[model samples]
Target chain A: MTIKAINVRNQLRGRIVEILTGPVLSEVDIETAGGIVTSVITTRSVTELNLQVGTEVLALIKATEVSIAKI
Target chain B: MTIKAINVRNQLRGRIVEILTGPVLSEVDIETAGGIVTSVITTRSVTELNLQVGTEVLALIKATEVSIAKI
Candidate 1:
């Protein structure tokens, strides 16, 4: 139930803002350092149970989900 | 080619660390505020062409990619 956040160097990053677990898929709170809060759900069971607000979370998200953009 | 970063409210966030476009799919550099750098690719044509270092990027990642975990 302990899913380690894969650090994708030269990619993207975030912090574990919140942690909500369930019997089925678990939702992870990701607060993008830029001030955005993203709730990520996973089928894997998380039991570490040490997530808190402002905790560092990594987004090893795949390329299919992310794309280049200009602000 | 003006693709906007979809902000996943209550989800993850990041900055457009870099933007390298090609004739086809484009590669986006996302520096997670926390420190992880992730590259996201998209088939959509991004024409805004206004990305740079330390730019705010939103992850809008799907639940299937995110999961909860302890420290």
Candidate 2:
């Protein structure tokens, strides 16, 4: 299904630079303009999305799950 | 308690620009180098962290929770 819109605020657009596959979780690294955005998602999603190196994708991050650190 | 290190990979440093509070969760808009990073964390964390406007903070995001959207 095609998503019209999403509530996630931080959406970094980039290309998949690397994919580190694990038992359950997989790390998909995207090279964005800001920097390399690393995302660890389910291995199942990795396959379902047909993700690969050079595939353009957006790193979607929800507001609620974001933690803050004092610097 | 002071945290020595964390496993989260994405840590965007920025300052709090705006805060929209709610009953349970609060929206924290941080002005980072790339852009405005919005976070919706628990109201308790907001209070416990002593977050306020102009507070310098690092927005931490876990890799596993990041979603991928192909474009």
Candidate 3:
């Protein structure tokens, strides 16, 4: 699938090591060479993507959404 | 700030623990209660956001960009 979002610059490649599915939300853990990139997505997307353990995926992140805090 | 993106469902709150700046892209490490949510963003955004270590920010992730792969 081709994503047209130009701000989607980060494409971290990793494997789906674990998935915690919920009714409204789902937590996916992607193990990369650097570290584990944990993403909380929707259960609907999980079902649509057919994501499971051992699945390889690219965690695309946009800089705009990555808000910074000073805590 | 209000983000117009309705699909931005996941909002992981974390502190900016580390940042690796480059010419174009910058890697930011956010430490959250759940885990570390790493984001690769443009250096410009990082500068605009004035991100620094110990800064607290929300990592907003859109489900669509969180692609899945079966490996």
List runs of model 3 lying over 4 Å from the truth. A1-7, A67-71, B1-71
TM-score of 2: 0.86
Question: Which segments of model 1 are wrong by more than 4 Å?
Answer: A1-17, A36-44, A48-57, A67-71, B1-7, B10-17, B30-39, B42-44, B48-59, B67-71
Q: DockQ values for all predictions?
A: 0.39, 0.70, 0.23
Docking class of 2: medium
Selected candidate, larger DockQ, 1 vs 2 = 2
DockQ-derived CAPRI band for the predicted complex in model 1:
acceptable
Tell me the tens digit of each residue's lDDT in model 2 across A1-71: 88899989988788999999999999999887667789988999999999999999998998877889887
Give the candidate number with the greatest TM-score: 2
The 10-residue segment of model 2 chain A with minimum total lDDT is A31-40
Give the TM-score between model 2's chain B and the true chain B.
0.89
The residue-by-residue lDDT of candidate 3 on A4-65, one tens digit each, is 54445456678889999899988898886545667887889899888888888877666545
* TM-score per model over all chains: 0.51, 0.86, 0.50
**Model 2, retained fraction of real contacts?**
0.77
Report lDDT (Cα) of residue B67, candidate 1: 39
Clashing pairs in 2: A40-B63, A63-B40
TM-score of candidate 1 relative to the true fold: 0.51
**Model 3 lDDT, full chain set:** 0.72
The 0-to-1 C-alpha lDDT of every candidate, in the order given, reads 0.53, 0.89, 0.72
Q: Which structure among the candidates has the greatest lDDT?
A: 2
- lDDT of each residue in A1-71, candidate 1, tens digit only: 55354443333356765667776756665655555445555435344444566766554555566444333
Interface RMSD of each: 4.1, 1.5, 5.9
